[model samples]
Target: GYLGCQDTYYVGNFKGIGKVYSQVFIDSYTRVADAKLYTDKTALTAADMLNDRVLPWYETQGIPILRILTDRGSEYKGNIEHHAFELFLSIEGIEHTTTKAYSPQTNGMCERFNKTMKQEFFDTAMRKKIYTDLDDLQLDLDIWLEHFNNERPHSGKYCYGKTPMQTFKDSKKLAVEKNNEILYLDYISDSQNLTDNQVQNL
Candidate 1:
């Protein structure tokens, strides 16, 4: 199963710089989510978000995204040049899957995260009328989302009664342990190879 996932939630144009779009991606296992506001919903924007922002962020964690799950929006579908998203994923060897139409469960992790972002973050922002522009919304969102991932307790079954940040930290710990095991195996294999070479020489 993919630990990383993505989805787009439409808020429509509000104060009218353009249509309000949020590109959200969640770590499926940990429920850690990133929600970024965009003025337009286009394939190019989606591609850039994933390629330039999301994927790079994941790379910093020492793991290439194993897969990404998203809803079937036109922004994610089209021809080669037009579908820069697919191109980028293909180049990076990240498996991309789209949810079945109307079956939100197919990408339920992201779908739920998107809903939470709306209810908890965007809705709160709008209710307070705190923002004069998208930039303001963006600023507030960054702070709220940090709290959501780090301080907010995850009630999901897989969360192990921990906050998203705790779960994510655990995931990293496991990844490091797995890497260490692989290195140990490589060392053993090299030792065996050396023994064989020495035996043949004798």
Candidate 2:
């Protein structure tokens, strides 16, 4: 999942505002988040974020990312940055896909996570007047990330109202069993077809 702070903020002043850009990438499997503060929304910056922050964190966790889904934002398309991103994904044999234009729902997971981050962290920062600089904001963000991953309860509940992590683990087990059944059926069908072909040859 992905989250980004638009480069505009309405400070308490009626006539004053501040522009800060930030982006985050979350691992759907582990619910871990990696965020960074950026001065611009350029494609170069986006590429750097993917390279310097997102990929490294996933590597550290030994997570094998299969796909990356994102919106059709300018920063993620139609440029050398796109090529760079594709190259990175190619090296890892991961698919990179973009959502349909004007369809935020296609990327709903990231969008919803973004809203939660803003509501839970940014609002608190603004209320407490805590962010004096980008570094300060980043520090607060790190603290909030810990709370989100370790303490916050995700919306969906499983057996006995277990948390997302627990539910996900259970789901993975079921998925493995289902996949094995499918593969076995496919093998059986193929074997029967081969036997029929041999009888026809006779």
The best candidate in terms of TM-score: 1
lDDT score at residue 62, model 1, on the 0-100 scale? 68
Please, what's the RMSD in Å of model 2? 7.2
TM-score of 1: 0.81
- TM-score list, all predictions: 0.81, 0.65
| Candidate 1 lDDT tens digits, 22-136 | 8888888788788778888887778777776677776787655667877788877667555878877777777877888878688878777877888887777788874558888
Off by over 4 Å in 2: 1-18, 79-84, 157-202
Instruction: Write candidate 2's Cα lDDT for 1-202 as tens digits.
Output: 2222211122232112246666666555444456676656666666677777777754553444557776677666565434655556566666677788888577666666677778888877878774557677778888887777656666632424444445445555554565467668989999999999999999
lDDT of 2 at 72: 73
Instruction: Give the clashing pairs for model 2.
Output: none
